[model samples]
Target: MVWLTMFYLSSMIFLAFFSFFCLLSSFFSILFDVSYFIEWDILGINSNFLVMTLILDWMSLMFMSFVSFIASMVLFYSGGYMSGDVNINRFIYLVLAFVLSMIFLIISPNLVSILLGWDGLGLVSYVLVIYYQNEKSANAGMLTALSNRIGDVAILLAISIFGYYGGWNFYFYTDLIEEDSFKILVTLIILAAMTKSAQIPFSAWLPAAMAAPTPVSALVHSSTLVTAGVYLLIRFSAALEGSAAQTTLLLISSLTMFMAGLGANFEYDLKKIIALSTLSQLGVMMSILSLGYPNLAFFHLLSHALFKALLFMCAGAVIHNMKDYQDIRLMGSLVNQMPLTTFCLNLANLALCGMPFLAGFYSKDLILEIALMSSINMIIFFLYFIATGLTVCYTFRLIYYTLTGDYNLHSLSSVTDESYIMTSPMLSLGVGAIFGGALLSWLIFPTPYMICMSLFMKTLALSVSIMGGVLGYLFNFMVVNYSLNSLYFFNYIIYVGSMWFMPFLSTYPTSKSILVMGSMYTKVSDFGWSEFYGGQGIYKVSMSVSNSLQLVQNNSFKVYMLSFIIWVVMIYICI
Candidate 1:
């Protein structure tokens, strides 16, 4: 136990210090308008050199600071959260490895190095997801691993394409690649990004991945794994500028944002609700990036990382105290018992809803205004606003269920601020959740984005947010006997609640037919047709022939002479 404590403290302190150093470096890089690219030639094939490259720009440095900061807090928090487990050391090691992989990804501009990090993330995340060693964890891990594998394959294909173009440093070749090849490269990169970021068709894993330990979820969902995709696209955003791919990305991301928000509203699991919110925010980042505002996306990514990690940590604390019951229906009036935790939870939730002047407000509000100004189709615009409203709606809904309602857990349950170890991290992140956005905005942008929209357009985001919050709180208000109106629209609720049945769509439907076909093949080839035409048929034929020959032999001289006479007569006729 003493050793574990030392391990946690040392790791946390080292990471915190590193985070600060990176932050300082980011400021210096930004002030000087300079980027450092350090490359070492590892192998050479003619003119094409396989090199290990590291990029230290303001962007990479800033992201590294955020990741390290979050990881530090998460590691510290895990010390308390996993205190009872025997394999806490293993957990700590896995989390550290996860952070290292993310760092590798953040620093590398080369595709080869990025792949090393990318595959590391996928592998480590799968192990973390299945850390609990249960059926749910196993299933979730498989989904997460397999979903990310699609992205890995995309990256590998992209590497091969890059090899054809003579280098793996995509940063240098983004503008130089030919039009047709650029399109293919962009598509592969986008696909890889989509899978990692858990965009549509690839989103089920994000929520399912909540099966991981809360600290792992806090780290993975917030900064390390899911954001890898968005970060990758941000790096490749230059190639995407003014391309048809951006339009497709915009549509897909908008739909993803809308879908996640709507799904969160219907979800009852506390962690799952938060996971869905992460998905929704990911969509927001992706949508903004697709609109040719990679800076805004990066800003949001940094800001969201702070608050989302806080949100997951708060959820972890609640789950930790409530005897592992994650159903929000069983939680209520938490503020009465756990004020500090409840306060942090509310703060994170508000940040998520873009409450004025919070971290989310700085980034989310700008993105919305800029998106409003963009020349997008009505459908995409509608999706953007509706998705934003849904985000607020679900945030308020979660707040009402888990924070404000009547206490629904057993009378004997002891739910309080567990320890300073947990609360300290929450408080630290609470500060970030509140101020991280404004600070990031100042650092990331030299000048503020100029907004020139009509009064109605200016107020539209606020209005929808207000309306969504009111509806969210009011819709869940129940008296002594409230009829379950949701049952009336059961199918619709199930469809939307289940992320348009995405979990089923991603897993079952795609494989169901194939599995059925496989079953048919098994029956036909192995049991029915193969029995007659394959080894079984040959064996049966041989057995019948041998039985006849044995019977003829059993008939002694008479049968043998008769068979010989018949064979001789047939031979004579042939002659």
Candidate 2:
């Protein structure tokens, strides 16, 4: 009891300090408006400044508020949720580090500063993912780090390209790059952002991240971390505008949105479903921002953080109460056991479904309108609309399996209600889901209705919600295998077998060319993954060649001395 008390107080105090920074940033940004930032001039170019000087703008302020509130609530809630656990101190410390890193990231003014925060965030999050230090969590941490490392390599290549030819005109600076070499660099930057944001083909690891603890998931999925891709896009909007990478961004963003939404529906682990849902939503935000409506992406990101954090925490609470069995099929009628958690979960799901009255509605509507306005292709419009439909379906699935289905307590009826520490964050985040849209009115479209949008978008969004609720409810009572669908086998083959093994195989598979003594053409033709049988040939050739070099190293000194003596004799005779 004494240990628990001491840990909670210390955590609360640490949380208070971090929350203060988030609040202070928002408060100052609002008070100062747009111009009140620390503009840094490094390398003779103006850059962003969050470390030394941070200027809070409308977008940063809003997100900072959401981030801080959730940070505090999560800290407070985790105090109770993890109260008696031995890992409590370790968890709280990482939470503090995570929030601080995000604050620096939010307020940082330049690419260098933001990248520093981005890297720190990646580290602490990996640590947090493996907080349980279990085998599953450790694997999740490695996958997350591996993805981030790919993003890092892309970033380094971009930086090199940017620096070699004048550095000032690239994305971080207010100036745009018109030079050919710099244009190539900027293209690499887009690749980095896509990988970091986990778009389309790169998005597989997010589902794997479900092995993390719930609070870690809430923090990562919601505000600062996963949206790092969209955040980078928005932060560097001036650079991407009318750039060469638009076509690439457009296609990948569209694919990410559609694929991730489908992946969400195909998941049964409540956390994995939410994880995929976030990837899909981030995909939507990336697509919208690619069209240069960053404000809308920022808008959706805000609501997404709040509402998704709520759902994750609520899901966590349910798991906590039920002793950590996370299968949704085992979680029917939790409404009776925990009424507050149920209500909070419903509010979050409503927001996620983008019910016209909730927080997600405004953001989702704005992004679609922007997509239509910016895109010339009707195919893009249709793709986004279909993704919206899937979003609704998955959100409702989460709601039904956790709350209103038949009570299948299965001898687990004695689960207790969540404490104040666990549920308070859900309650706070729930309020945001309820009323955050009007507060974030800066992002709302001034035009009430549009011909291309109103009829199809509203009709589709509403129909999706209704159909999703009905279907998820109808199927809630049935016992079914909720594992991967028909494509799971295929997905495992490509994403698991191919991706995991390709890096290790790419080099030696072609080293067969090293062996063949025939002409280069004949050897090149023979090269493949042939168990390096040809590599053995190369090994023999290498042995012969290396022996030749060794003979030189061993005999070169004596040969050079004899040559010198002969040269001296020749010089004397010539003289």
Candidate 3:
């Protein structure tokens, strides 16, 4: 295990350097307007063939760099986080497998190879989600796997449709694809991306997946698994331009954002609040992408990854020191005990809230501004800003409960930031959280965005954010009797708190119907029809026939002589 830890750390260092080099290369390539495509023929029939294709454009390279960099930090953090686990080696391997799958997904331009990577992410994520091997972990893993499988099936369907284009290389046919055909393809791809990214109907799995270890949660929810869908759409953005798929994504993603924000405000679990925050941010990215700003969405994707990963690591540190206690109600005033960890946590939270100049600010502010400028429905327009306010609202609520409220834990509980391994990765990511957005913003968008909106609309984002902050403080910390669970709105609170009953809607009805049908089928086919027509029926019929035969055999002996004599007399008479 010690050797494995060292090996993983060394790999992280190498990955960091490689990521920097790739980012540099991508930066230069974009500056030079360079694009490269590489392909290798792997398998084929007479007319149909599978070719492994990879694109080395700025998008792929830059995204790959970010993925590698984050995975490296996660692996480093896991060293201290999983120190007590006996299967630490297995954990490391699974994380590596996850990173590799993400890399594959990142580089491929062909749907076929992307499917390979996509399915790999789903499989490896399930393994990681259930790594604890408990009932809770198992159930969470099942949900994660089943939900992602929906996306996998969608991709397969999209691939089948892409076969009409003579090849699965979507990059080549972005402009060549017929509008009608591209419409269907875009919808399939959006469905796939939606599930992977945990949008709307498929959103339950992201927070549920917190049953995994904290490090796994950090990695998966931040950059690898959940972002897979966003990245997929980024790659397919060209085909999706001017399509209805974008409108559909815009509507649902905005709702998802608002829903997750509302859910986070009601959630008490520390990690789950962060998980919901991730879900909300994912909606932001998807909505921006749907609004014809894939580049801006990609920028936010990278920026959000930096801060969100840091947020998770900070939460992991707090949870580790608090004796694995994750409930926010059980925690308070951590600034006195674990100053460094709390500092990182607060920084990440502020960044998540789109604080000015943080990683989230550069991208989030840009997104809101551009969203305001775009001529969208008034409802969606307001939902976008309201979602932004909700982000600040929940984050401030989280901060009040976790970092500023009175100490709520037992006096004996020891909390410290002495773990160098854990803090080192956290501090490293903390730097990224602070600066990664600015750096990536300049690199990704060499040209500044031109914005034109009314003064009131231009200031709406900040106004909402400030109002949310004030309300968050007043409701969460200042007020003593405010509760969403009060009799006034219990039902509404429950419905919103449960993420609009998405988890129940996705699981309960379908599961109940399947179970009922299965029971009926078992009774009718397995027990009733199978037994009667199969073993029992055969035995009964055979037994009856044998009994009659025996009776005949027993009576025939005595009667045979008389019968034979009668038959002979009748024949002679007739003759």
Candidate 4:
């Protein structure tokens, strides 16, 4: 029955056209009632946002437009990309559901409502990531799911805690205004957002996520999923106002930016490099927004969604040409092959580097402006400034290496442009990537500096553009010659080895000590690593505990259940 329904041409038309209609309906809903929320209470169940004021704020509406616009593009692109691939009908259905969830997420009014939309999108992403279900992709999907589920659990706990003290109603966030608990609640929510957004320490999943098909990465990085962090931070803007937590957020964000940019330089996989670069950029935006500038973050997010989407689809085209090979080192000089794909890829990278008159310039420069406001310490400001330099390093590195390398693959020529289903939308996205930043408004912001954004910000954007282009060429040598044995970089063991310098760097040398003479773990540490370390016994004890757990699971379940039943009978008799 499922095959009969989806295999028909008419059914394909209906599914594609139906989702388009849904988008139109959603847009009109935003158009008419977006000023403030008008909601209804559902005492017996969860409150729905549709009952609140129409969710037509500038932010929600803008994101909704992005959802529908890019979604339409992806759907159209998929028709060609998936045409001959096996099990494509299932892919279409999942894509439809994914788009719907994002639209709902955009308009959701309360935390519960937003979570509903958030998890829906996440579930679809998990399905899509493992669509191939090979060993690599399966591991990618599971790790991504586990990391995201950890975030979800934290969110669930925070919501339960808030509901206990605040109210069961989801719309009651406003009810807790000026309360200390509300601030704590927002902080917990921010932690959940950071994990979802792939901020550092939790960031390893994103590179793994590249195992998914390229279009999935396009959608994930571009619109719905990754932006959830910025959305949550912006949505709860006032709650985070005036907290010391902003500085901590800035530090984490800066670290993610630094590490992702650095990691991108070292990775061999074409898509992984871009993925790392994107994670870094998103981290920088989240950090800047947390420091009390949401609009700047919004602009950067908007532009990123445009260019990153283009870059991923174009990369997909390259992979499709090469029969799914991912390493950039093996492929090159396809100016004739996949001309449209190459063009779009370069255009997107240009925008990503924030070249003047491109979409990225408007957004990234705004972030730099916020960083330079002199309210924060000079050291922190310089850190963000340095991050901007790193962004350039990674963005244009892909640009230089991918196009400039001579053909290394055996007997391969550049194919012609992608089919209509692919090329048309790819071209449109490239257009957007080029012009989206050039056309910002003076009236909306209306400041002396704001009016002159082109004159001021564009200049900075051009300089960064030059920096990226120049550095990419200069270090094209380093990118190709990157060695594991030389600087001993990517040797995480070396980084760990260097942590012994902690005592030297620490202001409190005594506090930095890992030794506690009588403590069990320390004694084990001393035994394992050296005469000075003692964690070996602790490791042995942990292994024993793990073996004990294995025995109970294997041999004791029936006995445990029988004992539980006997204890229950004894308790009842006593009662």
Candidate 5:
């Protein structure tokens, strides 16, 4: 225990120091408008160079700082959360390794080097997701791993394509590639990004991955794993400008945004709701990136990381105190029991809802305004606003269910806000959740984005947010004589509540057919025809021949002479 404490403290301090250093370096890089690319050539084959590359620019530095900072806090928080577990040390190391993978991913522009980090993130995350060693965690881990493998394959294919050129560094070759090759490369990269980011059809893994421990959830969902895709797209955004793939990404991301927000509104699992919210925010970032604003997407990514981490940590605290009960329906009036956690939770939720001046407001609101200004079709436009409203709706619903009602847990429940280790990290991140947005906006953008819209257009977001909040709260409110209205729309509720049956779609249909085919193959090949004609038939023929030869050998010269006389007699008779 003492060693574990020391390890956590030392790791936290180490990461914190580096985070500050990186932040300062990022500021300097931005101030000077400078970027440094360092490359080491490892090998050359047929004029194609295999090199390790590192990029030191404002973007990489800033993202590194945020990742490091959040990781430090999560590690600190885990010391308290996992203190009783025997394998705390293993958890800490895995998390640190996860952070290291993310760092490698942030700095490397070469596809070859990036795969080092990319695959590391996927492999480590699967291990972490299944850390609980349960069937659910195992299943979730498999889903997460398989979903991400698609992206890894895409990256590998991309590297192969880049090999046709002189180098694997996409930075140097993105614009130089011919149109046909560029489209193929861009499509591969988008497929990769989509899988990593958990866009529609690939999104089941994101919520399923919540089976991981909360600290891992806080890290993986917020900074390390999911954001890898968005970061990759941001790096490639220059090449992605004005392409057909970009339009497709816009449609997909918009649908993802809308789907996640709608699903969150109906979710009961507290962590799953938060996970859906993360998906929603990722959709926002991708959609804005698709609109050709990588900086804005990046801005939202950093800001979202802050509050989302806080949100997950707070959720962890609640789950921890509630004795691992994650159903929000069983939690109510938590403010009385754990005011500090409730406060931090509310702050994170409000920031998520894009409450004015909070971390989400600066980036999220700006994205909305800029998107409205862009010349997108009406479907994309409505999806954006409706999704925005859904964000607030689900948030308010979560707030109502978890914080503002009668204490719904048993009377003997021992929930308290006394753990300094846990609360301290929440407090530290609460500051970020509050001020990180304005600070990020000022630092990331030299000049504020110009807004020119009519009064009605300007107020639409605010109006929708207000309406959504009221409806979210009122809809969840209960009275003694109240009937179960949702039951009347049972099928509809189930359809919408279950992420539009996405979990089923992603898992059952494909797996069912594949599993059935495998069973068939096993029956026919292993037990039926192959057993009869392959192993059994070969063994029988070989054994029969061996027995005849053995009989002849046993009979020795007598049997040989008898057989020769029999053959001679048979020949004479034939003649």
Candidate 6:
């Protein structure tokens, strides 16, 4: 086990360095407007062909570098967090596989290879989510897997439709494909992206998947699984420009942002709050993508990956020392006890709120500014504003509840930054959270955004951010004796805190009918008809023949001979 851990750490460190070099090379490629596509004619069938295509551009390389870096940090952090587990090697192996799948998805520009990576992510994530071997993990894994299967089916449908183009690769023909002819394919692909990214209607799985180990959550929410959808959209943006599906995505993503932000404020579980925040950030990415700013969206995607990963590591550290207690209401006054972790947490949270100069600020603030300048509907504008505010609101609320209040846990509860393996990753990501935004902003966009909004619109982001902070502090700390015990409040709590019944809608109505039909089939066909025709009927017929044959044999030689003669006569008549 020690050797295994060392091997993983060494492998990740090597990969991280390799990715950094690749990133630098990609930047040069983008500088010269050089993009390369490598294709191999793997198989051909009649008029259709299956090609394995890889695209090397700034976007793919940069995103791949980020994924590799974050994954390396996660693997190092998991060594300490998962050290006590009996199946540590298994966990490490799965995480390695998860990273590989993300790499496959990152480079592929063809539908076939994308699906290969896409399904790999879904399958591996399901396994990771259920790693704990508990009922909750089981339920969460099922919901997660089943929810993502919708997207898988959608992508398969898209591949069938893309066959009309004579190949499954979109990068070569994305600009040439006519909007009218490929509208359905675009819509299906969008649906697949939404499912993978956990947009509205499929948003339930993101939070439920938090049942996995914290490192898995960090990877899934930060860079790999959820981001796959955003990356797909970025690749397919040319086909979707000005399409109805894109317009619909804008509305749905905005609503998703608002809903997730509100739900985070209502949630008490530490991991779920962070999970909801990821959902909201995903909404921000999708909304920007829908508005035809794929570059900005990709920038934010990279920036978010840094801080979110750090945030999860900090949360994992806190959870570790607190004996796995995840309820924020029960945590308090950790600044002195674990000052470094508290610092990391605060920095990551600030970054999440898009504080100026932080990683999130470069991407998030710019996104909001661009949205303000664009000619968008009033609803989307407000959704973007309110959702931005809610981001800060819930973040501040989380800070107050978990970091500054009185010590609320048992006397023996241990809280300290004693583990270097865990704290090292947090520190690494914290640096990125602070500096990554400026670096990526400059790298991705050499030309600054030119905006001409009025003063009021200019301060809209800052104004709402301040308001959200005040509201979060007031609501979580100042408000006391507020109860959800009453009938009305209880219902509202379920509706808001449970994400507007999305979990129920995604799981209950569909699962209930399917389970009922399954039970009916088991009783009627499997047990009843199958038992009779397959087992019981055969046994009864065999018994009857054996009994008659025994009676004929026992009667006597003469009787036996007569019976044989009669049987021969009957056979002759039948023949």
Q: What is the model-wide C-alpha lDDT for candidate 6? A: 0.91
Ranking by lDDT: 5, 1, 6, 3, 2, 4
Segments in model 5 whose C-alpha atoms lie over 4 Å from true places: 478-482, 525-575
Worst 10-residue lDDT window for candidate 2 reads 497-506
lDDT of 6 by residue, 346-452 (tens): 99999999899899998998999888878898899889999989999999999988899778989887788989999998998999999999999888898887888
lDDT of each: 0.92, 0.72, 0.89, 0.70, 0.93, 0.91
Error of 4 at 28 (Å): 9.7
Off by over 4 Å in 6: 175-181, 481-488, 525-575
Candidates 2 and 3 compared: the better one by TM-score is: 3
lDDT of 2: 0.72
Which of the two candidates, 1 or 3, achieves a greater lDDT against the reference?
1
For candidate 5, report its TM-score: 0.93
Candidate numbers, best TM-score first, in rank order: 5, 6, 3, 1, 2, 4
lDDT of model number 5? 0.93
**Residue 253 CA error for candidate 3 (Å)?**
0.3
Question: Between the candidate structures 2 and 5, which one is better when assessed by lDDT?
Answer: 5
* N/CA/C clash count, model 1: 0
Could you tell me the lDDT of residue 84 within candidate 1? 93
Candidate 3 vs candidate 4: the TM-score winner is: 3
Best lDDT among the predictions, by candidate number: 5
Error of 5 at 210 (Å): 1.0
Model 1 stretches with alpha carbons more than 4 Å out: 478-482, 516-575
Which residue runs of candidate 2 sit more than 4 Å off their true CA positions? 1-32, 39-53, 164-174, 442-458, 475-575
lDDT (tens digit, per residue) of candidate 3 on 142-212: 99999999999999998998888778988778885466877888889999999999998899899899999
lDDT of 1 by residue, 93-126 (tens): 9999999999999999999999999999999999
Candidate 2, residue 154: lDDT: 70
lDDT of 2 at 253: 84
In angstroms, the error of model 3 at 552 is 20
Report the lDDT tens digits of candidate 4 across residue range 1-575: 46634453454455446545644554555456445565665443343222322365666766666666676677667767777877777876787688778777777766666777778877987898899879988877876786788678767877676665544334456556567766677677778888789885567677778877677788888987888877877776666667766667878887777667666666668888888778878887888787887766776887788898998888888777777788887777766576778889888887877776788877776777756653777666656666677677766667666776667667745455747777877897898798766543231233534433345544554565567567866776663355645555446643432222221232133234532334556456544465433355666778899987887677677868987999999999999
